[model samples]
Target chain A: MGPSLSIAGLEVRDPRGRVLLSVPALDVPSGALVGVEGPSGAGKSTLLFALAGLVAARGHVRWGAQDILALGSERRAAFRRETIGMIFQDFLLFEELSAADNAALSALFHPRKARAGLRARARENLTRLGLSGTGARNVTSFSGGERQRVAIARAMASNAPVLLADEPTASLDRAAADRLIDDLVTFVRRTGTTLIAVSHDPRLIARMDRVLRITDGTVSGDTTPNTAEGAQ
Target chain B: MMAVWNALPALWQDIVVMLLLLAPSVVLGGVVLRGFAPWPLVRAILWRFRGASVLFVALIAISVGMGIGLLAQERGLRQGTAQAADKFDLVIAAPGSEITVMMASVFLQPSDMALLDGVTYNEIANAPNVAVAAPLAFGDSYGAAPVIGTTAAFASYLAEGHITGRMWATSSEALAGTLVPLDIGDSFTPAHGHGDGADAGAHGGAQLTITGRLAPTGTPWDRAILVPVETVWEVHGLANGHAPERGAQIGPPFDPAYFPGTPAVVVRSDALWANYALRSDFTRDRETMAFFPGAVLAQLYQVLGNIREIMSLLVLVTQMLVTAAVLLGLFILSRLFRRQIALLRALGAPARFVFAVVWSFGAALLLAGAVLGLGTGIGAASVLSRVVSARTDIVITAPLGWAELHFLAGFISVTLILSLVPAVMVLRQPVVPSLRS
Candidate 1:
C-alpha cells in the first residue's frame, strides 16, 4: 500500500578500504514479508545493521519518506527507538531476565499511553507466540526455536512499522522454523508491518511474498510469484 | 550511628591496618575500595588494589601520631606549668641541656628562691589585698614518689573548683588535695636520705597526720602530695625525742639524738621577699621565670609547628592519591563494563542514572574507611591517656578537636571527590557503541 523502506546506492566497505557490497536501489512496500537471501559473509547482516542505523556507511535509508541517516545522532536514536524493531540471529535476550521481560525491554524507549501495563502486553505477546507457559523462564533456558519465537515476539511487541530479522529460522528445525515464520508473517500482515528477514534457508526463502538475492553486495529483482503450489 | 558502631569492633581488629595503610593510598590512588562498591548497575566495576588502602592508612596514621604527640607535649607543659606556678610566681630551675627538652623538664632550686624579693606566708598574710601565700618545699622522694610540703594556704591556689574537704590548721595536721586524696586517718611518712632521719625517727623520717581531704579537681594536684612546709623541716630536722638536747655537742655515731647535717629546706617570713608583678601579665622578672604551664604549652606547640605541618601535608598528599586511584578505577572499571552500561543506556536510563549507580559503590567503601580511621584514632588516644597517667603519674588528655576535624575533612573530602569523578564521564559518553563485541 505504501513504501516502508527505501535503500538507494547502498555501499558497505571494510575498515581496510576494501569494497564489500553495493546495492543500487531497493524498496520494500508496507506489509510485505520480504526475504533477503545470500551466502555466508555476503554482507546480509551488515546490510541489516547499516539499515538499522547501527553502523556507519554511505547510503540513503529512508523509513516512510524521511531519510533516517540524515537525522542527527540523538534524533536518529529516538527515531530508531520509535520506528525500527530488530531481531538478532542469536536471539540476544538479556540473560538476567525472563522471556516476557526481554520482550518488554524492547519497548523501554517507546512512549505508551499507560506505561504501567507494558509488562502485561509483553506477556500476552509471548503467549500468542506459543510461549504461554514459558513467559517467566529465562530465554537462556529456551531451545533455539523457542528463542527465535521470543525474539520475533519482542520485535513485534514494539509495534514498529519496520521489522528487521537476521536469520530468524537458521537454528530451528523444519517444523519449528515453519511455525516461527507462520507467526511472523501472520503478525506482520495483521498489523500492516513491513518485514525484512535475512536467511540462506531455501524453505524460508520460498515462503516469503517476495525474494531478493544479495551477491557481492548487489541486489536485483526476482520475479517469483507468492504462489506456494508452484514452489512446492 | 548504628552502622558506625557495628563497624567499630571489626574496624579495630582487622580493618585498622588496611585503613591506616590504604587510607593514605586511597587518599593517594588506591582503586580497589572505590571499585566493587555495592551499587548495582546494568554492570559494576572492580579494582584489585588490596595494598593501596594500606598505604593510605599509613599516611593517615602519621597524622594521627603527630596529633597524639602534640597533645602529649601540651599536656606535659600543662602539668609542668602548674608545677612551676605553685613553686613561686615563677620557677628558677636549671635550663635543660637542649632548648626543646628544657621546656619539658625544669625544677626550681632553693638558692633560686633566695634570689627573689618575696615574703613568707606568715609575713604576707597581713599584706593589703593579700589572700594567702603558701610556700612549697619539694626534694627527697620516697621510692621515686615526690614529697611536696606546702601550707594550707596553698590549697586555695591548687583548687580549681569544688571539692569534698576544706584546708586544715595546726602544724602536724594536713589536708589531702584532689590529686592525692587521703582519708583523715591516713599518715604520710617522710621519705629518708636527708640527714633529718635520726631526729625524725625510723625508716624515712617523721610521720604526718592527715586532718582534711580535698575534692576531685582535674588539675595536676590530683597527682601531688599536700602537706605543711613546717612538717618538711620537721622531717628534715627529725623532730623527735632523739634530737640533741640544747646543742650539747652533738655528732653522728655518738647518741641517738646526734645526727649529721643534710640539705636544709625551710620557709621563713623574714628570709624570703618575693614580688609577683600581678599588674604585668606576661612580663615578669627576668631573673625569676614565672613559667605558666599554659604559656609553656603554647610555646611548645609553636615549636612543634613544623611537625604538625608535615603531618597535614601528608594528609593532603594522600587525599590526592586516593582521588587519582578512584578516577583510574572508575575509568578502567567503566571500560570493562561498557557493554552493560550501553545496554542500560539502551534501556532508557539517562547518563546520570548510570553514573549514580556506580558512584553509590564508591561511597559505601569510603564510609567504611572513614569509620575505621576515626575509631582507631579515638581508641588509641583514650588507651594512651590512661596508660601514661598510670605509669608516669602525669595526666595527659589527648586533644580531640584536630583529630576529629582531620577525620571529618578526610572522610568527606575524599569520598565526595571519589564519588563525583567517575560520574562526570557519563555525560560525554552517553552513546553506546552500536555493535559491542
Candidate 2:
C-alpha cells in the first residue's frame, strides 16, 4: 500500500475563538518527508492536527481515499492506534510509566496484536532507539534528549505508515538536533512511510523533501522537493 | 415487632454501652488503614464508608437495644411479685385442707376467724408495722369489696408502706382499702352487710374513723378492709383468742377484749419467719412453700434460653454476611482500579504477577475491617456487663472467648481472600483499550 494523505478545504479554528488554519487542498505521497513551517499562533500545529484527524475540522481528511472523520471516537482511536504515529509536542508520555513501557503502552492500544507479540515489538523498538537496558527506568528520569529519542521510538514502534510529529526538535542542541533529524529521515526512508512534521527549526526545515510555509490561516509558500536525501 | 419498636428507649441504653466498647478501635483502625491506600483508593474507601457500610453502626446499635430491653423487663417483674408476698405475713383461719392455695387465692375465708398476731383497722394504712393487732370474726363481701374484722394493724399492713398514712390507734377508728378513699371521718356499721343507709343507725353507727389511706403498691393489699383484731374476738365471743391452745405463738392484742393473742395461722407466720430468721432458726410445716426469687428467675431463663441461643446464632450469621459484603465491595474496587493495573501490565509484568499485586491490596483492607469490627463488639460486651453489674444485681458478664475471636479472624481472612475475585478476572481481561486510554 502506498500510504498517502489528502486534505480538502480543511478549516481548523483556534480553541480560543479565532480562525487558526485553513487549506484549500493538499496531498502528500508515501515515502515523502514534508516540512511544515510557520510563526507562533500561525496554526502550523492545527494544520498538522487537522491532517492527522486529531482535531475537529470543517472539511475532509482522508487516508488512502477513506474518510478519516467519518469514524466514531472509539473507532478513530483504534484507527489512530493501528495506522497513525504521533510525536506530540508535550511528548504526552505517561509520567508514571518507564520509557520502554511508554513505547509498549502505545503498542498495546492497538486492538490487533497478541499481548506477547506487542511486548516483543515494544522491546525491539526501544533497543533500536538506543534505549537498551533502560526499559524499567521511569520516563521522567530520562534526560530531555533521551526523552525525545524515547518519544520518537514510541511514535515509530508500531510501524504506522503516516508519522505526524508536532515539533521534532524544538529543544535539541544543534548537533543533537542534526543527528536526530538524520535518524528520523533514515527511518522514514527505510519504512517507505510518509512524514509530516511541524517545526520552526531551520535545520529540520532544510532536511525535508518539500516545505510548506503557513502564516495567519493561509499557506503562504511552498518549496519544491529538496527532500531527505538532499544531504546525501 | 411492635414491642421491639416500643423498646427504643432501651435501645438507646444499649448503644451507649456499645459506644463504650467499639468506638475507640473503629476510629483508630480507619485512620491507620486508610493511610496505606493510594490517594484515589483512599477517596474510594471514604466514599464506601459513608455509604451502605454505615449499616455496621446499626448492627451494633440493635444488639445493645435488645440487650437492654430484656434486662429492664426482668427487673420490673421481680419488684412487682415481691410486694404481693409481703401483704399477709399471717393468714389465720380454721385449720383445713387446701390451705396453701387458699392463702394464695384472693377469695374464701373460714367461718370462725379469730384475733391473730397482727391488728387491723376499718381501712388500710401505709405503716402496717405500727398498727395495733385486730381479730377477724367475719369474712363477707358486698360489691367486690371484702369485709374483715381485725386489729388496726390490718389497715397499716394493707397499705404496704406508703410514704404517708397512720395506723388505727383506737377500737372505734377504721380504715378502708379501695372501697372508700373519701370516708376518713365516717363510722363503721358491722351489724348490717347491706342496707339503704340502715346500718348507720346503730350506736351512732359504731363511730368508725378512717385514720389513713394506703399507697398503691400493685398488690392485693389495696383491696381489703381493716378493724381491730379484738373486734373479731368480741363478735365471735372468743375473747381467749390469745391463749396458745394447739400450735401458735403469742403476740399483743390491739383491744381489751382480746388483751393477748396467739399467732392464729402458725404455718403462714412461719413462712414469713423463715425469710427474716437466722438459718438455724428456720422451721418447716407440712404445708410449707418457700419462694426463692433466684430459683424462679433461673427457671424463667431456662424457658427462654433456647430462643436467645438462636438469636445469638442469627447475629453470627449476620456478621458473616457483613464479611461477605466487605469482600464484595473490595472486589468491585479492585476491578475499578484496573486501569492503573494495566499501566503495570504494559510494563512487561506477567498477567499472574499483576493479579497478585491487586489481590494483596484488597485482602489487607478486608482483614483490617473484620478484625476491627469483631474487636469492637467484644470490647463493648465487657464494658456493658460491668455497667449492668454496678447498676443492678442482675449479673450478665460473659466476654466473647477465643473461639469467637478465631472465627472473626477466619472470617476476615476469607472475606479478604474472596475480595480478590475481581482482581483475578481483571488480570485475564484484555488490556487493549487500557493501554490506549
Per-residue CA lDDT of model 1 for B267-335, tens digit only, reads 112222333332122133442233333455556667767766786667556655665665566565556
Stretches of candidate 1 off by over 4 Å are A1-3, A31-41, A86-232, B1-161, B164-276, B279-286, B303-306, B345-434
Question: How many clashing pairs per prediction, in order?
Answer: 43, 39
Q: Estimate each model's TM-score.
A: 0.61, 0.42
10 residues in a row with least lDDT, candidate 1 chain A = A107-116
Q: C-alpha displacement of A148 in model 1, angstroms?
A: 7.7
Candidate 1 chain B, run of 10 with poorest lDDT = B259-268
> Which DockQ value does candidate 1 get?
0.11
What would the per-residue lDDT of candidate 2 be over residues B223-257, giving only the tens digit for each residue? 54555554444443455334435213222423333
Model 2 chain B scores worst on lDDT over the 10 consecutive residues at B120-129
The 0-to-1 C-alpha lDDT of every candidate, in the order given, reads 0.55, 0.54
Query: What docking grade applies to model 2?
Result: incorrect
